[model samples]
Target: MSTAPQGTTGGKTGPARETFSSRKLFIISAIGSAVGLGNIWRFPYVAYENGGGAFLIPYLAALLSAGIPLLFLDYAVGHKFRGSAPLAYRRLNRGAEVLGWWQVLVCCVIAIYYAVIIGWAAMYTWFSVTKAWGDDAEAFFFGEYLQAPEEPALGFDFVPGVVYPLLAVWILTIVIMVAGVRKGISRANVIFMPMLLVMFLVLVATSLTLPGAMDGLNAFFTPDWEALAHPGVWAAAYGHIFFSLSVAFGIMITYSSYLKRKTDLTGSGMVVAFSNSGFEILAGIGVFAAIGFMAFTAGSTVEDTAVAGIGLAFIAFPTLVSQAPLGSLIGVLFFGSLVFAGLTSLISILEVIVAAVQDKLGWARVKASLAVSVPVALISLVLLPTTTGLFVLDISDAFVNQFGILAGALVAVVVLAWVLRKLPMLSGHLNRISSVKMRTTWMVLVAGVVPVVLAYILVNEIIAKVSEPYAGYPAWMLNTFGWGMSIGLVVLAVLLTLIPWGSGSKDKHDPEYEAIRAAEDKEEAR
Candidate 1:
């Protein structure tokens, strides 16, 4: 068959061919994009930190109101356009392709650091096998693996740690992705996603059997109504929802671009969101159950039993694994499973960079992937300076994870919700294939309530942080700097909105834009 319709085409193609069914492909792609590190690590932490059970209320609320509706909007953009972000936006709004380019830039930056984290996971897997972590295991795990070390500390220098491994794994990721979506990404997910679920189930089963597992589960599920009263908790819930759902990052746009137009928008979004949230809930159960087990056996509190940082997954999880029947065998499987999860995510991250380079530069996928891989490797090297590398990774992650994603999401929501008047189209598409229509309540939620809530989060978070005192700087001036830094992403997004993209002669006839009538015409012809 012909190569997939990737880049934008010049001539009219009668509403680009739909080789795949949207309902089937979109579900897979959406799940692939959503089920990443956020569900595994970030969601549990935010949920646990934000009053555990209390966080659930706002989280589910956002899921129903903001997350699902917004996700449907993203899926509609991608599936409707049958192109990646750059071309997708070019179809929607000629001027807003700046948003497209911005999305690309953000993905590129995040991918640079994401590779290092995956490499760290790889390094941890090796360490697990060899049991080579010695007395300095804690430092090695954190300094070397968790945080990239800098300058004359253990595992110092970028090349030995960050640069080479990142390059190697990224190249590997590119190879998987370059194999094309169906055989490469989809096939891998079909295999790896099941494995992740199985491993997770086994872990959960074992944890529940542990002495205090039920207690920990209760702590997790037990209601803490007062916790919901805290603004910070609500903010954390919203942030986690965005992060876990993989909204705002352009991944959904990119991945969904591969989807066929007839996909069940509402149902697929629900599946993706619910499945990912289920995994997070499962992971939480396993994490806290293990925490309870370790605490009871070791005579420690849950806080004391719990280990944070990179070592937790490697050293701590392995400790639990070692105690299981066939400990070494299970340990290998656990870390091995983590490697697959990490790799799957790593490739998706790399694909963002690859897709962006191809769109902007018009290079072939393989060439673009290779070009991006080199710079990413060099950047990863920055994390090799003792534990300083690790620290930088965290800083980079923090910026992109919340600020970058939230900002991009804000733009996306504004574009789709306001600029495009996309909700009605989304509803119409879903109403066609779906048995049940998404309630009108969601339209109000997406356009009015969600944006206001996101804006509140954006402002309150920055202001709250800015008001805090810090050392070694003039407090007032430094506070101003803090405020600026916090709102930096929002400012960057606003700046992009001011710019516009060059439109093609075909702009007015964009099959993906105001061409629903034309789409139907093409369908009738087919």
Candidate 2:
């Protein structure tokens, strides 16, 4: 195993990895990655379904035990190794190189579908004006807007409505990613994140003024406490926290690799974790408030109007916009926030793929970005823009989140904690650089509690899928798009690892390699 020293250029072997321009830039960029559609679109709905207010108990619990700790683990590995996921893992244990590639490939898969969702948001941002979704928001979104097919299958028939916006999304993402980390991602986040928060706050304020806003707030916070006892609710909380925090998909690891050597790893993780959760709570208030308004207008209850994921974003929100005071302005603010959130997340996802390629193949940043982005763009334009694209996206998102990311995180924890026995050393590294030192409890959560909980979630998901087709989709659909895609990722990961690690001037000769090796030896001796 080899390691690259902090701030050293790989020279002939790899392009020099760039550090973030400042600590503030790093934290902002990281928060941009963590606070995405998951918070605004997914969290509210997951909370509503799980226990409304009661879900917060398990959600925060998962955050403390699993989310923040795993984030710290990612930070320690990348900051210590000063490389991408594959490089970091390879340096840790040559045999575990495949785990790194697995996460990278998972990001690649996520990028394609994620871009499509962003494209949808992009289109909705424009459609917000004049209430283009018309009177029947659900029908307009599903039928007139998407023209979703009667059945799901791979088809190339492009929907111009979807394609045009999707094209714009790819172009925007490419420009930012090609610009390099500090100038592109960090700068973009600085502008996008604050603006997103302001617009969302305004939306929440307006919703509070609407009739029945209290009802919506009540439904959102009023938890079904009994639901907390259900294992499924706990699983959902962990799953939501995992996806919402954006860990185990190579994004955090790659971003941490760009941090300066003196950066505070644990403090950064805590900021990102808490910032992400705080935003979700805000989104919940805004979302449910709006939903309550919708129910009031329709002479119904909050439960009747409540939705999640794409439905909440496109259908329910658009409907509320049409009926709200200053309908057009409110609509713009709502959809615009989605675009900002989605763009930041999309850039982070693409960077994970770009970083992995640059490290493995020694490609320049622009070249690596293009190499990964082109294929993903083609997929989004060709497959995801079709009328049936949403269906494909739905199944793909479910499978990837459940099997791809959760499985990857589970493996990473096992390797670092059990196989390599590096949890203590990793914690020590965090304490050294961070103002907020990690206690033994963090180690217990990362090495013991987190892994067990993650395993339970994975096993439960597998059993549910095996017992019946997911969401009542056809067996072949689940088998092909769901199971097939998850298996394909593993195959791709193994194949990627088989490629020879390229040659370079600083490949195996960096001083950091010896330093890390010495640390590991000392730990093992203890």
Candidate 3:
């Protein structure tokens, strides 16, 4: 009767087995992951620090060469196998399976800390909307909530009251995960993403009306070539590009696994990447416009650029809101937007871990979701009690984000683009619906050039951070410990590829794989 659901024939693993097209979900999931904390806080500061307008040069360069290419590569690998990242490697090359699991492991570490920060954003948003605390809100946040001893002191203390909001955020995330991909994640993104876009546009429009907005625009756009000479600028640009685009994380790979066979992988990846870049540009306008207006009025130097984090929102934004008309209402909407952005990204992170559990353990979706949630909640609880939980998030983010993410990305590029012959097949499949095509040489660049650049960035970052030590490492060994952790991840990926996994002799799983395929076919025909 009905010509079978569109994707059902690809097997239980195919996206058609669910109600959402991987293409649609991919866009939602990709956008959800992209528009988060970094977009709002980090990009403006990094640009300001890295020669203002000149930073755009390398950043846009990276978007084309590094960010977009890898995005397509990840989607191709995931959708081709229709399995979790680790299992995708096992299917493609048995030895490479070790590399895949390493990636999955990175996601495990990142997702835990990510949930804690998302909880923090949620608490901020809640406070914003209800005007719950009023004028006392700032004091309550920095004083009672953050437990700083006094204004601007930045001292840390434990607050027993912090656990309640953290628990609320954790529970909310779990509920979303329990809904499964189609109903929960996909549907929510379809709604939230459009709202995010509209709200951002509104923010940008209002910002332009602020006097001295053009001054800020020039500061961001007019390039100073000298910045390009400094390697650190390049490194910052590369890292920001990766972070903003949400590449090299298992999030993209995990999202792609749910994709359908007929979906245009290249097209989808391009759309997500381009859309993300558009948001970054818009975010840049909104942030700098305000910064510019403030600088113009306050007589602050361009060099006196502020650093990244919720501090920008908590301190700078509130200051701005306090000065502007309808300050409280605008502040509420701004932070509320951030809460949604954080939640959407949080949802994707939880989904990656949940998908891994469901596949590996053969658990139902609900159990897998819960199993993943409990452990993360425990980790969040550890940080929730300390005012320096933000500090822990920073440390974990550095080790996992800068070192772990870069390493994971380099490995993925090497394995897929070079060793696995990713581009030729990937390009052939993806180019069918596209105008521009990836050449073999392009794949080689992705495999070779990109990793080399990433490797350079990783090393330089270690030197720069250790040499400077923004917060000052307590001892020499602390610096040593950080390097060891970073290097160990790279070494681990290399070692696993060298070992033998019984030469594929123990069991023939292809029959089981094929049986699943046949069931998928029958389901499609139904």
Candidate 4:
């Protein structure tokens, strides 16, 4: 209920919020966040696994029903409140501020390991010249390059190859964040996004010319219509759309909080959602085409060569580069695209943490940026660039994405729909500012459909993980890195909310807050 002093840009605010220079900048930066390493590395394999070309039906349906609706909700909340997640949520219901902190904490945990992946991309960008991964790409990536230990619990032992590049990545991220939102994040995306598209297109074009490209495309697009009936396929479609769009992570909310008042919230959400999914489709074509070439070389089928996550990016792709015509050049373009995609996404993730610190503590932007970045950088340098880094990163990524991001989002929807009963007001806000007006259907999706789907995903994933150790890793490893980190994040979020909100005025005492309260009181009286 606290508010900023007079002269703030928004009528109700706690701190001075940053705005993107234009709608174009906001959309591009948003697309950059959405079109990340997952688009290139995760989506192709997900499609191949989940009914191939027919996966598109469920994926697009999820986008419409869940993805875009949640996106529009986040945009509406942020723009209407004119603050970061914590401040924005606090305005809605003071007790719900912890939800925002939970999201920011999730972003911090993600940022810690995400930087390490960007570092790997950086190293590979150089390694592309010589195909340094050599003949056994898998062995080279896991054994020589990463020096992965025999066990997940082996602990950190720094590898110089990864540590140096990781340090460089952290430095680059800190520099961009320090430059402020419009000057740093916006401008960087202007350059990175278009370049990413051009490089990816070039790689895709080259991949299609390779021998057996059609076999890869066939493996990718050939549909098994029966797979649509399976509950798991629909779940995978929803999960991919959710994660790929970067919702439920506070990235979209924070980014939207930086927009001008008159911006089209629904139109912007549509652009970001469609742009992200479109890029994923393009990535599927490119990835499968390259995999086909690899299969042709190995005398195997595209299905045999298929993989996902880090393996697909660092191992399968490198092996393809070593065998393909103009292998070195292709390698450069491929990894270079990864570097750009990872950097832009990294910037967006870091911005969430930085914005939270500034909003809560009234800290200068530089101080906030450095305060969060320095510790995370040190952690990355000491732990993530080490022998057991990949195992740690893998476990942490799975838990944080499932437990942290999704759970926080579910809480938000329940509070808005059932607890506060604010969905109608939020829908009204979106309709007022957007060219594409939201209807009751949009409200149903946000308040009812999306939350139900997310809750199912959360419960189903938890049951699956508890019933069996994930990926056959030891129980201790899952307990330590997976469940342990997730529990720690929740504890941290609660602890953060206990800190007194340092806004200059008392809660529920600010003029704007009183006015809102008065209006609600009148509505109830009527």
Listed in order, each prediction's TM-score against the native is 0.82, 0.94, 0.84, 0.94
lDDT of each: 0.62, 0.84, 0.68, 0.85
lDDT of 4 at 21: 76
What 10-residue stretch in candidate 4 is worst by lDDT? 1-10
Candidate 4 clashes between residue pairs 3 or more apart in a chain or in different chains:
none
Pairs that clash in candidate 2: 13-504
List the candidate 2 regions with Cα displacement exceeding 4 Å: 1-14, 505-526
lDDT of 1 at 225: 84
Cα lDDT of model 1 by residue, 354-465, tens digit: 6655544445555666787666656555543334455445545655554566766676678877988877766665565654476587678878877887887777655654
| lDDT per residue as tens, model 2, 244-276 | 888888888889988877788887788889999
Q: Report the candidate with higher TM-score, 1 versus 3.
A: 3
lDDT of 3: 0.68
Q: The CA-based lDDT of model 1 is what?
A: 0.62
What RMSD does each model have against the real structure?
4.8, 3.1, 5.6, 3.7
Lowest summed lDDT window (length 10), candidate 3: 1-10
Clashes of each: 12, 1, 2, 0
